[model samples]
Target: MKLPVLSLLVLVASCATPGGDAPATPAEMAAQARTALVHVEQPDPGSPLLQVDTAAIADSVDDAKARALLAPLLSQIADLSLARTHVSVASADWLLQCQSLRRLDVRACSRVDDAFVRAIVALPQLEELILARTATTDASIDALLASASLKRVWMWKSAVTPAGLARLAARDGLLVDAGLRPSDSSAEVEPKPEFVNLLPMPGEPALDAALVPINVNCPVTGAPVDAKRTRTVNGRVVGFCCNNCPKTFDADPAKYEAALPKP
Candidate 1:
């Protein structure tokens, strides 16, 4: 009798667990994609790009059941930050729960649309929006204007056009493109086989991450290396859209590195 009681106590004590919710780790979230399915596939804090969507998983089963499975997964995404990694939202509900979304920054969200607007409308101080390459059009300009708390709107090279820009100009305290938005010097320049042309910009537009552009003269074509598509360093031949530049640069990286801007 004493042995049986002692054994029961050991099993229960071995199963002791933390009271708080177990924050899903990158590995556990990746596993969620396996059995549950998702619309978009992007990993965070765990691995490289897994561009599969949970919606695709739902669609495989049937259309009617798709939205149901998506609701819960999307709700879990309370805060979305796409710096070193990108994530797929199952739906808009996931973003809405972020009680303190003071700044809703969306960049390179090519699939975004009006459905996501209501999620951000309640954000009291949405001062900055960098919609560099998203699908949100001038039509959604209404949502931008309706946000009584909005200050700065950055739709650099997205759906906003010249006519659309004029329509948005009428907003009371908002700053639109041309003057309000930072101008892209790259757009003004003609692509050529020379150093990237510059026009009086005080400083370069901040790069996305730890990438330093190294422009080296092509040893083979003698044109700028933008055309050279491939390169190799430390005994590895890498490919590039601007090809031949690599062979020349790989020949001597120290020389090219000397010319490159310090990261």
Candidate 2:
């Protein structure tokens, strides 16, 4: 007996594979991901594995969508870029399953905190990590130190302090890009003056010309001091590079005090 067209189509679809239509091949999954604006690259034309890059569609991807798109391809993806996406710690947990991932970029992902760092560092094959502009702080650095395979980390604009960066830099065979090169850390390097004149605030007394600043450089920023911007702290005169530096110094005088030259 002849079947209706709709029924025939269903029968054909079921017969096409033992179960429902066979689960999508890695190549097919890659194509599907591309249709969603995710950039997918195969090692070669015929390779089933992929390199998923969501940077182009970062604004559109949230935690749920990230899971949906990456769950099936986790094993196949060697390099993944979720840079600037809205993914949080929830999505970061999925990365632990991605053992094949070699390089991962989460740059500018504000939700990537120490918790997220702790999660992804568990990825055994992760080699290069891009955490620049994220919320990861010094604690994240401590978490990353446990990773055996991580070789490089980019942390410019991150919450990591200079000390944290220094600790990470001390690791053997690990490269850190914190917006400063090895030469920039030299003790002999002189601080360049960013601003010269420091106008006094309304009703504030003018700076004393005869008074010398205890520190030749702005302790807070490591910039050349503006002679006109001076403040007396703990019976010592401190100088700053620009008008803003004084405010930063005021907020936490003790923190910057350590950089000042001692008597």
Q: Which stretches of candidate 1 lie over 4 Å from their true place?
A: 1-20, 23-80, 83-91, 178-263
Tell me the spans in candidate 2 whose CA falls farther than 4 Å from its real position. Answer: 1-22, 44-48, 182-263
- Across 62-151, the per-residue lDDT of candidate 2 in tens digits comes to 786787666657788888999989988998777888888889999989988888998889999999999999999998987788999999
Candidate 1 residue lDDT tens string, 118-221: 45665555555555556667777777778887766667667777777677677878776533545664656556755542233367574322232243444444
In model 2, what are the clashing residue pairs, if there are any? none
- RMSD of candidate 2 to true structure, Å: 18.0
Task: Give TM-scores for every candidate, taking all chains together and pairing residue i with residue i.
Answer: 0.37, 0.60
RMSD for each model, in Å, please? Answer: 21.2, 18.0
What TM-score number comes out for model 1?
Answer: 0.37
